[model samples]
Target: MSTVVAVLGATGGVGQHVCSAFRASGDRVLGIARRPSAAGSALRLDLAEAAPAQLAAALTAHRTEIVVNATGGWVLSAEAMHLAHVQIVERLVAASTLMPDPPRIVHIGTIHEYGPVPAGTLIDESRRPEPQTGYARTKLAGSQALLNATAAGTARGVVLRAVNVCGPGTTSASFLGAVLDRIRDVRPGDRVPMTIADARRDYLDVRDLTDAVVRAARAPESTVGQVINVGRGEAVAMRQLVDWLLAAAGLPPDTIDEQGAAVQSKGGDWTRADNRRAARLLGWQPRTALDASLRDMWHDAARRYSEA
Candidate 1:
């Protein structure tokens, strides 16, 4: 039976892909976002401030059985970020309670919520979260709400704490997205300048992440309410990733701005994902290799650039 899935923040980078993946799998996907999409798929509701009553009405109207929260921790702004990551989750928990058969929520959390581990440590779900930044702290709070509610038997949901995601529909806020912009912006002679903070991060393709999300939505009650870690299972150097991106895109190398590249990033020096729980729990792994992911990202950027 096809599930009725409502994807919150459906217009955002990861959210759009989540909606597409669910739709491609023959699920009835309702795109819920603040703004209407040009494709006419959005439900056009701001989830960050939506009351429990409003959410219940929407769920009832759509007959939603699975809700994929594809929002949170993407934007770095303060008030809105808190609302998106924390407040919206509280509302989602509340709304689920009003349903006779509460919809299963797949809250997409981030690896940043684990903050920085030691240099060579694998970021398993067992590690106690030490979120460093405001964005991550907020995301952790959101995850805590779901965890708490699920434990109390008040909410039916699972949390997929994902890694650094990159793929098609990536925006300028991301590393590869910024690189794509610089690649498209410069003329033949002008060199693109970037402030590179070289750190090893576990990066997952958006498609890969969304695939796990769809699986999570359909997982058995045994798997529901579990916090599964999802990612590529390995960290790659930022510089190495850039090289692969250029190679995969068949683009010429842009000059790396070496003089100012040696700064510590906010997330910290290094961390990779431990995705064993995801495979065990959801029968999922990141099937898309980084090269293929970067290739797709570049090609998608090219298509959009041409359209623009």
Candidate 2:
């Protein structure tokens, strides 16, 4: 059946692709943003201050079947993390619940919701969340909200806890983008202070992540209350990814070296997602490889930089 899907945060890194993926899958996408854009039929809505009635009015015009809460800031901002998390997810959930025969809600949370796990262990939904940062803490709360919504029969919901998603359009201004830009600009033998060895991060291609969302949103109602991890089941070290990027750019392996940094700078280690549930339940897998995808993203960013 043809579906109408609403995309909150429709202009951010993952949200941009989420919009494209829905359009590609033949879903009519109504994109919502704090600042409206031409990406789709824009809806002006600010989750933070919008009243419950206002939020319901925003969704009343469209008979949406799927609602994707792609809104949320990645880098820590001035706003309280929990407040930001609750505002976006809550607004959408509230709107969906208000609608008669509400649509299936898809909440885009982060893998950080699982907190810091040791390398080599499979990070799955069954594990209890032990959030280390305020961001993760808020995301965990969002996950709970979805579960609560499902249990209360307010709406059918699914929460996707995603990992580090890499793709084009990232700049030095962004978290990973800054590191990538710095590495690309550095000359051979210029050692930069890095915490690559400290953390094992799970990086997913934005394209592949979008595919998982599209699949999960269309899943059966029986799959409600499921918390899924959408990622490539590969636990790649930060140092390894940096090396891979250097190799892709034809830079020598030792061209960039990690300055023996302090404990806090090194950050936490990571593990890959156990996508068995996503595969069986959502029938999804990442199609893009890290090295090639990074190269493509770098070139695209470089082109954009030159154009600017």
Candidate 3:
């Protein structure tokens, strides 16, 4: 009895990995993206622009039991953010109503939606969101939509507000991803220029994050309407992460051009997830060691470089 799952943003950084994980689990997985299908059972339907009827038709066609909203991205514009995070989600809520038995929507939200937490605070599901960035504000709005729908009995879902994600498929759009893009090509003594942000944040392996997504999909109805925090549960210095990456790449600590670094922080920014509820509910916790994550990421980057 395989579950029918549809992953939006199937071709994206995190979405592709989510698709792979679900497929490997022997589920009936449909990879939905705006572009042509490349390697899986993908359907190209831009939910950002599609009507609820359109999305409902696709879900009905696939007999979708779970709809994973992996489509929200890091774009920083009012219209783009609204389309990806708010408008599209509103449509998904409406679309779920149109289903014979509405599917559970596992939305991939951001921990940034918690907005600025105290420098040493651990973020739990109880923190009131005061999202400042356009990305965070829109993502919060999107999560709220699903929550409201779930409360009203019009939808069933879980929102996994994820921390900073790392591991394979790290894109240049992110800080760690930016460093990885340059680290793979650097020799033992070659220098790489980067501006490491002054922040201490929790980082989660993408595979681990996907594992949580799968859990949310399979979780019982009791888990619906819950906003779960998924992460390593500890915030490490951003500069320390860069050091680990360089070490994994077999480069010297001096390989980083520290002169270009952002000004030092005096306990300026931080966030760590209190994953207790997640453990109690989903029986989920990150299993990958941070060092192992960095090492594997380095290997994947080198492998891609070789293939290229």
Candidate 4:
């Protein structure tokens, strides 16, 4: 039987891909977002302010079997982060409890929730979260809310702690996305400023992350209440990754403003994911090559540049 999936933040980067993946697999998709899109049936509502009863009615009316909470904010303000991550999640959990048969919830979480891992340590689901930034802290709170709901049997919840996601149509706020934006707009000799160039971080293709979420949604009830780490399982230096992106965009090696590329943040200095659980539980692994993903991102940026 085809499942009915509702994706919150359906117009966002990862959310859009999740909706597309489910639709491609023949599932009925309802997109809940503040704006309309081609992904699924539109339910225009700001989850942050929407009451539980309103959210419950929307889900029940759509007969949603799975709810993917993909809504998140990258804002620096603590209040905005809390509203987007924590408050919205709290409301979603409440809505799930009101359902006759509460739908499975796949909460998209961030690897940053684990905070700073040691230089060579591989982080798994068991790592103690030490979120430092407002974004990370808020996301952790939301993750705990989902886990708590599952433990109480009010919802079947799975938290997928995903690493940095990059691909075509990535948002400009992301590291790679910022690089793509610069390359598209700057001339060959023009320099672009960046930070944390030496940080070793994991990057997952949006498609790969979407596949894991879809699998988590369909997995057995035993998978419920589980916190899974979904990532590329390998770390690449940010400097090296930026060079790769520049090359993919056909930019010169000196395009980066070396003097301006000093470390501006320590948030991603060293972080890598141990994806054993995702492979074992969801039979998922990243398949897209880094170069291929960067190429797609470059092409997307180029297309947007032309249109601008």
Candidate 1 per-residue C-alpha lDDT over 1-308 given as tens digits, one digit per residue, 9 for 90 to 100: 78899988888888888888888889888888888686435588877668998998898888999998887645767787788889999999999899877889999998888887888889899988998888788988999999899999989889999888887888777777877777665554556567666678889999999899989998898987788999898888887778777765565566444446466444756868898999988899888988889888888888988998
Candidate with the greatest lDDT versus the true structure:
3
Candidate 1: which stretches are off by over 4 Å? 187-189, 261-266
Tell me the whole-model lDDT of each prediction, alpha carbons only.
0.83, 0.76, 0.87, 0.86
Q: Candidate 4, residues 244-280: lDDT per residue as tens digits?
A: 8888878877788755446544255787899999999
Model 4 ranges with Cα > 4 A deviation? 39-41, 260-266
lDDT by residue (113-148, candidate 3, tens digit) is 888888889999999889877888888999999999
What ranges in model 3 sit over 4 Å off? 39-41, 260-268
Per-model TM-score, in order, reads 0.94, 0.91, 0.95, 0.95
For candidate 4, the TM-score is 0.95
